[model samples]
Target: MEERKDINRLKVVLAEKKRTNKWLAETLGKDQATVSKWCTNTSQPSLEMLMRIAEALEVDMKDLLWPLKQQ
Candidate 1:
């Protein structure tokens, strides 16, 4: 499978938004463990989930992918 840029970028944006994993999970209607996995770069959110996260963070999806630009 192709790697996802959203993993680490989501973690950073979540931090900048002052959102905890538990808060993000609740906002996303997901389990905290799943949010934790996303934060730790151990897993990725689906496209639908990524859209939700982008909305929750009040950012465009491109912002999440921006962090990967130099890589």
Candidate 2:
């Protein structure tokens, strides 16, 4: 089993919501490039940003960071 931190909940949440980078950016009042980075895991959001993200996505903050078993 290969476990890597690259597996993030952001991508899954975005996909489940059918949200695009542009949509997330507009909702978060951020740049699309920044949202793109977040989705691609190139950068991580700050705690404050994560709170906003959880709210915007209608998910609990814990859900946004819930780790999975290594696979």
Candidate 3:
């Protein structure tokens, strides 16, 4: 199996939560481009940032991370 390369589930979770990148950026006081990079998995957020993201998204921190393996 090809090990999954993507690190975060930000994009998927955003979609599930019906949130737009723009909304997240505005809510987090972040750059929209930065949020886009995160959603595309082109970059990652610091643990602190991730925690903040979880709060803004109203989701658990674990939900922002990809599972080791999905059955």
lDDT for model 3 comes to: 0.92
What is the alpha-carbon lDDT of model 1 when measured against the actual structure? 0.82
Error of 1 at 56 (Å): 0.8
Better of 1 and 2 by TM-score: 2
Model 2 TM-score, 2 decimals: 0.80
User: Listing every candidate in turn, what is its Cα RMSD in Å to the true structure after a full C-alpha superposition?
Assistant: 4.0, 3.5, 2.7
Candidate 1 backbone clash number = 0
After superposing all C-alphas onto the true structure, candidate 1 shows an RMSD in angstroms of: 4.0
lDDT string for model 3 (1-71, tens) is 88759999999989989999999999999999999999999999899999999999999999899654676
For model 1, the stretches where C-alpha displacement exceeds 4 angstroms are: 1-7, 68-71
Tens-place lDDT digits, model 2, residues 1-71: 98557635888888888987789899988999998888778888999999999999998887778755689
The TM-scores of all predictions, comma-separated, are 0.79, 0.80, 0.87
Top TM-score prediction, candidate number: 3
Please name the candidate that would achieve the greatest lDDT relative to the true structure. Answer: 3
Q: How many clashing pairs does model 2 include?
A: 0
Which residue pairs clash in candidate 3?
none
Of the candidates numbered 1 and 2, which has the greater lDDT value?
2
